[model samples]
Target: MEMVRVVFLTVFMFFVLVTVHEWGHYYFAKRAGILVREFAIGFGPKLFSYKRGETQFTLRLLPFGGYARMAGEDPEMIEIGPGQTIAVRLGQDNKIKNIYLDSLDTRRNVIRGEAEFTDLENELKIRLNVDGEITTYDVNPQAMMIRGSQQTQIAPKDRQFGSKTVGQRAIAILAGPVMNFILAFVLFALHLQMAGIPVENPSYVKIGEVSEGMPAQEAGLKKGDIVVAVDGQTIGGDYKKMITLTSAAKGKEMNWTLKRGEETLSVTMIPRSMEGETGGKVGITPELPTRKAGVGETITKSSKAMVDTTDLIFVGFKQLINKFNMNDISGPVGTFQLTGQIAQQGIQYLTYWAAILSLYLGIFNLLPIPALDGSRLVFLGIEALRGKPVDPAREGMVHFVGFALLFLVMIAVTYNDILRLISG
Candidate 1:
């Protein structure tokens, strides 16, 4: 039952995060007048689907990733080559409104013949040999291409992704990461509202909670007791200095001066060495004072926190690059385990965890890795400078190779995660 709950929560969190990210791309692509073929969640067989306007929205079986597929994003275009049989249905204006590639035997009042040549993107016309006479027919702008039971709209040159200006294309690609950042900010603010904002002053360190039978509790220290000094050295409310002193004590007796409600008291305690570690702990958690925030304060504090978190993530990434440790990184399995642990703590912790994950997702996507948003922006920048886009075939090959390499890395990371879980 515990495992089940964890799995459910992990999947739910991933679903929410992925949906928001893809929605960003879908929204901006529509705004830029690009024809989005599909907005799909997950990568496996479709479980549900709905059509709205020119886009088909689908939910698939897998829950790990999703995408907003835009027309002309791929290098290969759907073609009706010479000698291939096809059927066409004409509208009132005598233009082909639907082109059927299959299932022509059952349909009535349709012209079936061999396709001599076709241009669906620019010319919007098809040349066919009907009863030994070759003739060309114009196709409607919104004509449907039917294959079996599936129907997809033909993308004209104007509605394709590549036809848009550089600015519009950049926005469509950049919006996904931007939306993730917005979600992180909103989550951070909501968490702060539910759980009071932390006090930023670092002058004094007070005991928030005391563990039973710990060194601090045995020394008669209680919650709300402010540490004034340690070993005759004034703390001056420096939390890090006080922590350093106690951790260095290493089971040695130390004199501590405490202030409790306008009363000064002296106490002596010995720090306990942590198991499998060098530092000594007194078993007391420091109090981070918090209070309810108003609307203005919430906005200010949340923005500050978001910025601080982003800086920390960049620092961490630098350190990771310098050292390049595999264990330092987490994959899907590790994230699932961590999510379960955080969800068990409380709603406030879970909300904060989600915010942190969202921010990380946003920042990670901005790295100049191939097949990512950052690399797309790089390509756009090159196109703007050169006044033309790169060769689509070469670009597509690079992305495919990058995607394959990333898949291998993901497999390695996931395997490591499983090993750690099993050994434990």
Candidate 2:
């Protein structure tokens, strides 16, 4: 049951994050007058779908990734061949309102014939042969194409993505990453509000709580006792250094000096090895100073946290590029494992992890790597500079190659994650 809960939480997290990212693109694209054909969560076979206005919303089988499909983004064309039979329903203006490529069992008063020529994007007309006579019919700009059990509205030239101005297109492409950053800010603010903000500096190591039956409790340690030294080495208020020393002790007996109410006392205990962990623990939590945050303080702290996290991420990226290491990179499998571990820690920690992940997603998508938002913006920049867009075929090919390479990298990283799990 615990494993199931972890899996469910992981999937839910992915769904919420990815959907928000894609919705940003979808919403802005619509605002810019571009046709968004589908807003889909996950990939692979469709599980459920529905059409709304001009967009089809779908839930797919896999819970890993998703996309918002804008019209004219793909190079391939959906066409009606010269000899294919099609059925059409006309509206009051005599323009074809619905074109049925298959499953015409429930239609009434519809024209059925073999398609001779079709231009759904620009011309919005179709030539058909009916009873040995050929005639051309105008198609509605918002006509629905029924194929199998799916319906997609036709995207005329003006409504297609490529027809939008460079500024509009860039905004639509950039909105996804922007939304991710916004989500991180909101999550960080909420977390800070719930769990008080930590102190910037500390001058002494104090005990917040002592676990029952743990070494610290057995050694007569109590809450509010300030740890003066360990093994005769003055801690100097460096809690991290103290923790390092204790963790390295690994079941070795050590002497601790504590100050309580102006009286110094000495105690002895051994650090115990913890299960599924790399260090030894005395079960003593640090008494770090923190205070309840007001609304204004929460906003200020959250903004600062976002800036700090972004700087750290960029530094990490720089280091990764300078000293490439497979172990330093993680894929979905590694993330799942980490999520499970953090989920066990409690909701506050999990929320912090999610906020960090959101920041990573936003920053990573802004990298000028092909098939990313940054790359699309780069193309738009070139178009603005040159007064003409780059060849669509060439740009599409570059993105395709980039996507293939990314997939290979994902496979390698996932393999490493599996190996680490098995070895551990």
Candidate 3:
């Protein structure tokens, strides 16, 4: 039952993360006037789908990841200006000739009437007979927008990803990871508000650790047991009050009221004095300080939590690269098992785990690896520097190779996780 709950929670969280990440790309692309073909959660065969506007949103079988497909992203068949009637011909001198367009209105992605075509031979005595106004401009084919897919063909270049400026393209690419970060922030902040921020030493004490054969251990007082009262007097959060009561009743029978796990228990034990300490010894350590936060404090702590978590993730990455310890890594299987373990602890802990995982995912996606947003940004960087885009075929191939390598690594990590589980 517990394992089932964990699996369910993990899958739900995965779906949310992937959807939000992809939606970031979808949102920014739309804002930039680029047509999104699909906003899909998961990969492989689709289980369900719906079309809205120019985008088809889909849910697939795999929960590993998701994607936002924008129109005219491919380098092949660059569309320029509206109008479907296009026929290209080169003269013997290899010059453009007889360009034709079929009444494609740039503003409206519609074709109302026929457009005129002219060749160099008839350039001197050109005849214009059209129902609609005709506007012509010299456009470079190389600079035209690329098509995402041929399914719902818009005016070749009307709302194309390739038509968008480099800055817009960069924002669309970066938005996925940015959304992940935002998710982390919101989750962390909410968790903080509910659970409270930690302090070094809290006045209110819970039994964190109990020494063997000590008074606490003998009384069946376990770790995470909260001491509520002693001898009918509420201890509250005062560690000093707890000590005074215990010290005054040393070697005498004392009734300790405990909130253990989810049950309230009454235990009787005689406190034993240590050699140097004045207070009675129960052989327990202080629980960390924690207090629920207000709205403002929640935001402040959440931001701090994000920064600290990011720093820790970078440190871990550094260790993974430098230490060369493959055993230290955990893939999907390990994460699933960990989720189960944390779920057994409680939902709040599971939520905290989710926040950490979200941050890790956001940071991981920002790494300049192929088939990732970071790599797309790198390609845009090249285009910005070179004043033109790279060959789409080459860029696609690189991403394909990178994806293959990453998939292999995932397989290896998953195998390791399985091995560890079997061995245990």
In model 3, the clashing pairs are 71-148, 72-146, 72-147, 72-148
Q: TM-scores of the models, in the given order?
A: 0.79, 0.81, 0.69
Model 2, 1-424: lDDT tens digits are: 9878877877777777888899999999999989898899987899999888888899999666678899899953457888999999999999999999887666778999899999998899999898999989999999988888667788889988999999999999999999999999998998897779677776788898788889999999999999999998898668998899899998899999999999999999899987787787998999776678999999999999999999999999999999999999988889989988888666777788888898898888888898888888899999999999999999999888987888789889999999999998
User: What is the C-alpha local distance difference test score of each model?
Assistant: 0.88, 0.88, 0.74
Off by over 4 Å in 3: 75-155, 198-203, 206-290
Model 3 error, position 56 (Å): 1.8
lDDT of 1: 0.88
RMSD (Å) of each candidate, 1 decimal:
5.4, 5.1, 10.0
Worst 10 residues of 3 by lDDT: 118-127
Runs of candidate 2 with Cα error greater than 4 angstroms are 81-85, 102-108, 114-117, 132-136, 198-281
TM-score of 2: 0.81
lDDT, candidate 2, at 312: 94
Clashes of each: 1, 0, 4
Cα shift from native, residue 279, model 2 (Å): 13
